[model samples]
Target: MVFALGNCALSGQIPIWLQNCRKLQVLDLSWNHLNGSIPPWIGQMDNLFYLDFSNNSLTGEIPKSLTELKSLISGSSSSSNHTTALGIPLYVKRNQSANGLQYNQASSFPPSIYLSNNRINGTICPEIGQLKQLHVLDLSRNVITGSIPSSISDMGNLEVLDLSSNNLYGSIPASFNKLTFLSKFSVANNHLQGAIPTGGQFLSFPGSSFEGNPGLCGTIDSPCRAINNMGIQPAISSGSNSKFGRSSIFGITISVGVAIAVLVAIVMLKMSRRGVGDVVEDLDEETGRPHRLSEALGYSKLVLFQNSECKDLTVAELLKSTGNFNQANIIGCGGFGLVYKANLPNGVKAAVKRLSGDCGQMEREFQAEVEALSRAQHRNLVSLQGYCQHGNDRLLIYLYMENGSLDYWLHERVDGGSLLRWDTRLKIAQGAGHGLAYLHKEPNIIHRDIKTSNILLDEKFEAHLADFGLSRLLHPYDTHVTTDLVGTLGYIPPEYSQTLTATFKGDVYSFGVVLLELLTGRRPVEVCKGKNCRDLVSWVFQMKYEKREEEIFDSLIWNKNYEKQLLDVLGVACKCLDQDPRRRPSIDQVVLWLDGVGTEGTKE
Candidate 1:
């Protein structure tokens, strides 16, 4: 049996009558206004393996009796029997619907306990680690105090464990490295101290998992100081009155100072030889003019991929080709920086993105973009040719698209509306969908910003998704991740304002806005005086509701002969723009629907 009433806005404490349903296997009451403490009787439910009471006003300490859950302590064999006998249809909803699961299949759901985002307090009971079959345990964003229970390492089957944004102190259990199956772990924004455990699954976790805990160290960026097993730094006594000790310390300090001065002098000599202190204006014999060489590119290598056509490319040649990234060579502007067109010495062309902003912020964007582009390789995705880190400047090289971005064609060019025929527009949508589908596959990647400006067009007008500076990696088990709200204004999903979370569904919403731009030949946000100003999404919905769907098409490409095809695509776009993210279809589904439209059009 299962009962899920999440996001229902229900008030008051959890009903006591729930104890009467002894056979219940799943109970979800999250995202509600329910108050008061969790009932102790809840631990008496022997068959319960999935319990979620997150995002509530619940208070009081967690009942220690929770460790006695029979199904979670042993296995789901008993719950499987009940599910087989009742054949209940259970639906799990975590921001999105799970499309009802049959009783037999429902037993396959991972055992979990969620009590995050609450006011619950009290140290975690060490005895609660008896749930050996539990797969997920989350108790984040609460006032829970005290150290993490070291006994939790015994839960061998655990996959995810989150304890962020709590007052928990003390060192993490070194034995946690024994959890071989653990895939995700976090204790961020807590009072935790001591060196983080190493080896096993801990090696797979990112540094973000241990953030906000300054007392903790041992990460690549934050190395731990020399300390004993008890985590205390050793200090020398200053009360010594011996003359021999004073002389020894003074001699060692002088030797260390002399060594540092010698090392600085040696480094300075090397820098001078590498052209850091002098600017050499070497003239190109063929051009009869001096070649431009940026001082920032001193001794910096221009790393290029094996597939790059520009062989023997150097940082000096790259600077000379773009005239040191002059304004005249700038081809476009992106959220991060300007895009300069580089005419390589080898007769090949490439686009160089010179990232702007503070060094720290630009460094993050540079790394994010490089990491994303390196992993995602599809026919419809832009290719990253190379990159360079020259002093404070960061540069990314890419294959220059001859036709430029879709935004320039759709909105900037006067004849763009007439040039992009209905068939070409349909093809662009299909290609973009396929590219997005690939990114949403195994080891999913979310393009936080999706708009026409980020979609480039090749010589053949094929769409290639670009600008991954705001992209993020999302594992299969993760539903969503909280991040700073970043995206183009008109393309941002409505739910982002409240949730501040990015998901695959959010990308679909932004793509829907792009589709509207294609069909209407209008910008996402129309600028006008008085009451005439309105966004394209609102305008499209108003027209559809008023039985004026035919009027929403771009007049330049609209043809009565292709009305059926246009309306079919319009329906697909409408589904993508569903107000509730759960109702929106996945990118894979969108690809199939689009292919169906194209197939039908061909047959006719």
Candidate 2:
């Protein structure tokens, strides 16, 4: 079972223990960059024969020990293994059909040698004459400038002899006449000279097989043997051969230059526009304006930021994945950016949000906002992959959520898909609480525009807090001032309409509205008082206190045996809706209550 996997172009050094395959019959690693001296252990492969490693990056002399396989190396094996060193050992016992051929994963065998097309430049080891079972002997395409070893002629099993495209010169041994079984023989494109044998299978090949030599008379039509320059060998030294050494060095130099140029460009751009507070951390090269997972909470090992794991994702990669911000790929849109569905080059589906250019000169503020948002992490919050800043364009990358925003599935008709489950609703609330809790306590960042539109949903029905552009990260040292009000009309806190103040309590109020929507299966702030509606939250609250809770509960929640659980959820939401900001429970407290409820539900 000899394999002829030459010129594979597969990079990387071969892993060491391939010889451990005891069943290996043939191996062909020729015409590749498989360098390093031929290991002597190859002689241990007793079932090998047809060796053809003529032209490759292999270095050092041929292993003299290869002469040992006198009785074992055969020329033929399965054709499939003919192109690879790996072979699947067939199991006749597993064969249920008439013919035994079947494919399975656990089966394996190895092919024989073909380590050519390398820098193997030494003379052909005379010991190769001992391979009686050898079928294919191609030692062409090398720097070995010597006569063809006379011993090769003794191999009765040799069918293919190609010693062409090398620096070999001098008379072809008359002993080659003894190779009666040769089928494919070639010595073309070499410096070999002298009279050629015109009989046997040699007659079939024309003078072209004997080209490149000014000497060497042959019986073929060209009569190259008629030339008198005979028995001359070319220089065979392989000196200072670095392969890609020159280009690789050049590429490294260019990469460094480009990186420096980018640094200079960023500096020039920053110096031109001052007054954005001295964020000295950005200039530190050791840190490189790193992207921190703000919500990272002791999860999987892969979640932790490791210097070895990932490189800073480029803007081009993000753009390509998100279809260069195509309108057709838009999955969700927000005040600051439009989220688009995209497929990464690595075949990973992702959600990429391309923000509109900050026309009023808010790009830096927007970028800082997104950076702060991207670093924040929570189980209920969407995972931000990385962000891209390509000139005036900005994009935020997030883990692709199969299920879209909560607004779509909750408010609009699902077209007959499964409704949100009570238990799932509770989980969503808890995860959302965790995110809000982080925003409230960890950094005190207030999501100014929290609502059903911003609570994204994944396929698992988990909730993620998104759209942080309107979000304002609290200063650790100074207070932030807001003189103008901003937020959706429906979910905006009652006081926010009259006062321009923003706080975590305002977000909690909005969240309360959302919780009520989940339970009532109604839009938040719908005025259902009279025929209109008392804004879903107000109506639900009035119904709950009046002991007519079921009137507002969606049938999905009312009919289920989980009324007690839904009531607990309702109570938590009610706490969030307290009029006084001081009266409302902090998001962390809300999270704790949901966790307690989750624990209780687990018992059922």
lDDT by candidate, in order shown: 0.77, 0.60
Best by lDDT: 1
In model 2, the runs with Cα more than 4 Å from the true position are 1-268, 271-314, 361-365, 413-418, 476-483, 527-531, 598-604
Q: Candidate 2 on 1-604: residue-level lDDT in tens?
A: 4343545665545445867855455454544556667777767655454344434466776787777753233332222231221234332111122222222211121112344355666677776776655555656666666778888887755666777777887777777766655645778777776667755546444455677775566552334321146443222212455333666757966998899899978965774343233221121121222232212222111111222112334434545555555555777756555578987766667787766633332464355555556557677777766554444445566778888877766654332113777777777777777888887777668887788878888888888988777777776754443624556645877776455677778888888887887787776633111222525666776777788977878776575567777777888888888888789887777777778873563121
Residue-pair clashes per candidate: 0, 45
The TM-scores, one per candidate, come to: 0.53, 0.48
- Per the 3 Å backbone cut-off, how many clashing residue pairs does candidate 1 have? 0
Positional deviation of residue 260's Cα in model 1 after best superposition, in angstroms: 16
* Model 2 TM-score (2 dp): 0.48
RMSD of each: 18.7, 28.3
lDDT of 1 by residue, 1-604 (tens): 6777877899999999999998787788988989999888998998888898998899999888888887778663333343222244344444332222222233335679999998999989998789887888999989999999888999977878999999999988999987766766999999887789987667657788999987788786566666555554213223575334877868967998899899968964663343222222212112223333333433353556666666667767777778777766777876457888999998888899988754545767887887788778899999888776555577898889998888877766556668999998988898888888898885499998889988999999999999999889997799888875567757889898668799999999998888888898776754211123237888889899999988999997788887888887888888889999999988888888888884564221
Top-TM-score structure, candidate number: 1
